[model samples]
Target chain A: MDREFRNNKPDMFTVELFDATSDLAESLAHSEVIMRFTNSNQVLINDQDAQRLVQEANELHQKLYAKDASRDFMRENFPRYRELQNQIASNPVLQEQSEAQEMAINFLREVNQEISQLLGIDFGSLTRRPDATC
Target chain B: MDNLTLNEPEVASKSRVMEVARRFTETLAETAQYRALEETYQAFRQDGEAQAAYTALQTKQQTLRMVTMLNAVGEEDRLALKQLEDQFYGLKSVQNYIQAQETLISMCQEIGDILSDAVGLNFGLACRVGGCCG
Candidate 1:
């Protein structure tokens, strides 16, 4: 919108740029990685047992750091917590969800690497918040 | 599966994706914030008084590098250095450049957020240089 830039004037570059960005956004939205991540996340969120386990873990974690906390108390409860986590992790649906989530992340990282290569700048880093260490 | 070719079809479309990325970058460069940053940066560079003040500050800082590191610099020298820095920062072009650069960074963060959410990973985090920004 600034009148100062020569490249900002009406031109083929502008049209191409707009079309490219639109196409990219649409493509990204329709990406299988995105769809899989969304579905897997929903499934994870809807798992009642998983939610209950998470809540229990949080409660136990809070109690571990309470004023009356003890290493022995942590040792006693931590194993049960780990057992529950292992059980939840072993669920076929959760396993698929976890794999899908990881797949999606890898896919995105590859995509970002490609973009960074094209721009000769780390597109992902450029877009990161200032306060973010990584 | 071990090599992470989760989807061959998606990988094949990498070129189109890069084209989209290039277009997006072009559009971003054309934005008011980017334009303002460039303009202000040029102005800052061309500003004789600001440049002189900055050069003087840098020279003084270099000269007092050891003393400052050891916290042995006198209060008078420290205050003088601080005053020089204040004068350099007080320039209109310098202030504008800093503000514009921050605005551009914010814009980049927003765009990165969208990409990260779409891909289900922190894209910005992955692209950070040395896992941090200066």
Candidate 2:
């Protein structure tokens, strides 16, 4: 028999199950924490200064890993890199984005933990990719 | 920033969202694949022969740790390890257990993808199920 027939022999069961999932999804979409995170992240992503700072950081990181990079060059640019890092860290939008993102992640973690506790197994672990290290 | 719409009328309470999560978990447990996986896992756990094969392989690996780490495992030891692995894999019970597990994992991954799409974060990644490496 096909999987659907096995899992959903009773149509009402499938409907109720999906309805619950959709309800949870809808609530998640309307969450204040998630909304704040999404909006703040978008603002940070759109900010020119923030974008430049990120690009500068990436370039500095790449240079640090470059085969031909000299110790002197690193020593020379390290201070500037630190300054840029501090600037990024000090940006209010970035900071709020970070906080909101953490809150959103925590929210999901709490939800998953609740489900796992109820189900007697780690739901997230069960849902992980087959090749995942865990 | 706009006040969150979550605080508006028709908002879902935390308890309600958790209820939905519980329902979803119950639905997942009722699936044929998940039931099969649980049954096969129980069988694997109860199978004395399979357990012995697994324990023996683990013991052999532990005893050969030094040789294996040094990449100097003797031909005889290598052959012995391969034989043990083959013997373990050749068990019908072990094979069924493994297949059942794979099927269940696949189904879970699909459901996780749906949850991730709805929640705007990779569900497994957000849960940190295995580790942060992925």
Candidate 3:
């Protein structure tokens, strides 16, 4: 926007950049890894047993950490919490979802690395949200 | 099922993703903000005065790192550091470089948001070098 540093055809450049960004996003979203991740996630979310287990675990977690909960109560419920987590971990659907998500994330990181190498800058770090803690 | 190892299909998909990412980076490099950032950075790098001021500030900071961490910096040392910072920021080239970087970062943030929304994940966060703990 500053005239001193303005490039020719700024508007056109912006449009092209946005279009390219969208294309990249679409390609990533449609990639086999990402699609597999999405499908597994959907399957996990749609499973009644999985949803119930997750909800129960969340409720128990809240109770364990509640202000009024006694230390003894937390100690007693901790094992149950671990059991619920193990159940979730052992579920084939959840396992598949986790594996797929990891693959998708790795694929995205590889793409980001390619872009960063080409641009000579950490694209992910540069684009990170200002308020992001991690 | 080992997510760490990419299968043949995943490898092919990753290549496609990188191709799109390359196009996105090329478009981004042509943007006005990117051009301004590059130009201003080059100017700053070539400005001897600005470079000297930056080096001075960095050296002072390094020298005072322990004292500053311990909250034992004397008035003289603090003032000296402040003066170096002021001098560094007062340069036209430095100011231009900072402005250009901020503008480019803002544009990149918007692009990151678009990617995150389309892919149902935080693109920048996911691509970060380390996970949340880092």
Q: Who wins the DockQ comparison?
A: 3
lDDT of 3 by residue, A1-134 (tens): 11221223223346678668777867777788888887898998899898787888999999998999999999999999999999988988878977887787787788889999999998987778878653
Pairs that collide in candidate 3 are none
- Residue clash pairs of candidate 1: A127-B108
lDDT of 2: 0.74
Candidate lDDT values, in order:
0.68, 0.74, 0.81
Candidate 2 residue A9 C-alpha distance from true site, Å: 16
DockQ, per-model, please?
0.25, 0.38, 0.40
How accurate locally is residue B2 in candidate 3, as Cα lDDT from 0 to 100?
Answer: 72
Poorest 10 consecutive residues of model 2 chain A by lDDT?
Answer: A1-10
Clashes of 3: 0
Looking at model 3, give its docking quality level.
acceptable
- Looking at candidate 1 chain B, the ten consecutive residues that score lowest on lDDT are B6-15
Error of 2 at B133 (Å): 8.1
Q: Estimate each model's TM-score.
A: 0.64, 0.81, 0.84
Q: In candidate 1, what are the lDDT values of residues A13-79, reduced to their tens digit?
A: 3454444444555456456666676678788788887677667877877887789988899899888
Q: Name model 2 segments beyond 4 Å from true.
A: A1-20, A130-134, B1-11
lDDT winner: 3
Against the true structure, candidate 3 has what lDDT?
0.81
Q: For candidate 3, give the lDDT of residue A49.
A: 95
Question: What digit string (tens of lDDT, one per residue) describes model 3 on residues B62-133?
Answer: 999999999999999999999999999999999999999888888788777777765667888889756762
